[model samples]
Target: MPLRVSRTPTIRHYVMTAPTFFSVEYAINPWMDPTTPVDTHRALDQWDALRRTYKELGHTVELVEPVAGLPDMVYAANGGVLVNGKAVVARFAHPQRAAESDAYAEWMSRHGYPPVRTEHVNEGQGDFLAAGRILLGGHGFRTDIRAHREIARAVGMPVVSLRLVDPRFYHLDTALTVLDDSTVAYYPPAFDAPSCHRLREVFPDALEVADADAHVLGLNAVSDGYHVVLPAAATGFAAQLRAAGFRPVGVDLSELLKGGGSVKCCTLEVHS
Candidate 1:
């Protein structure tokens, strides 16, 4: 099926109380440090600032109530991938996050997004990233490679499977950020040889982020064609975005970084 293209402005939806229960309850990825103490208040402040930044950019914002005991719930992008107002609910791999699927379904149903439930293990936007009409899917951690087929069936778009070699860049969003309909910025070393070659072939002119910037979760960013929202710490990546003709808006979410998520992790793009 041809991808849905509309003239309406893109809306960046987010969960308001994401950090209300945010903390490192378990060690899932390399970014997760159980020993690092989390400050709930700091997390809340940072998240709020990110929301405001989105609004300031003239994008509509939506919220899902944070459910208690679901600390990872704050990483809202993992809930599902929204396409043309329909949602493909994610099936989390960890038992600790299994309950999140239902919460996301309820939110989608309540907000007029019909949900497509899939049994294949996936982590929503964490592994599923859309670039124009193509869906780039990640495997080797968090999500199962078979889930790409289910997502392709659900969204009716070609899903490209990319194997992540490094655990630090476990999710596709961590390794790449879709800057625009035809452009992307990625960390080449994060993917396996075949996957890296595939990405280079697909996006031949794609920007390559430096290792220092990737280490700070720079590629885990949100872009709305013209404006790219990212972590303030990623100075090098920010410069690259500007050079690519995008306005880079940086916000500090170091508190949520404790849970191995960044700006894109806290935001979800809802298509109309």
Candidate 2:
């Protein structure tokens, strides 16, 4: 049976940063290997395709100017968590991505979303995801657990903390994605026992992905209630999404995947 669509498809607003300075120079996550070569042009093309996909889906796309040294800035989802016309800018744990906070904050402020910087190390939407009336926060890698409290206070929403145990799924967006207000798709092995239990309890009908799909960052997808944009390499996930009544649009982000990010990583949803 198909999963029930609880609400009409929402026209989302997304923010993206170009891959002009994209490269695999530093080894921050398990997916990044500095020894491998990166194709800047190909990365740009892939990102543009993703942007176009969002526009074609009737969603708005906003661009953030990319900085020369911050290659990971192209993963704009890490910039901040925007909700109700307010943004909680990321306080990146690594020095390499620390400067990106200011840029994102400035953009948010200029665009009418008041920005707040967190005292605890939080990687914004990278570790925080908005689902329904609450926020799902990930920790044990890039973001601190305490940041969840700060986020809850700032966004005025309840936050459920989920601990990520797998090094490869360092970010929540990489291991899991909210398909709609009441549904999600995730890899169980990526989270701890308690976190896994919490996920199952909260999202009983959530799609459980196989290891093959998880390896390809299949869960790093973006959805606007009806259409889901995911990695083209994750064919299995595409099939599962279709079975669940979602229109899956696959895009090749092979080049951007070289930097440990894909559709959801490159696109940050601005909830207002």
Q: Which candidate is the best by lDDT?
A: 2
lDDT of each: 0.86, 0.92
Model 2 over residues 1-272: C-alpha lDDT tens digits? 54555435789999999999999999999899999999999899989999999999899999999999998999999999998656899999989999999999999999988898888999988899999889999999999999999989998999999999999999999999999988999999999999999999999989999999999999999998889999999999999988888889999999999889999999989988
- Residue runs of model 1 more than 4 Å from their true location after superposition: 1-17
Output the lDDT of residue 258, model 1: 89
What TM-score quantifies how close candidate 2 is to the native fold? 0.97
lDDT (0-100) at residue 268 of candidate 1? 71
Tens-digit per-residue lDDT, 1-272, candidate 1:
53433212355554433678898988888888878899999999999999999889888887888889999998888999887556898899889888988988888898888789887898998998888888899999989988889889988889989999999998899989988767789999999899889888999879999999999999989988877889999999999877766788999999999899999898877755
- Candidate RMSDs in Å, in order, are 4.6, 1.3
Clashes of 1: 0
Candidate 1 lDDT at 206 equals 92
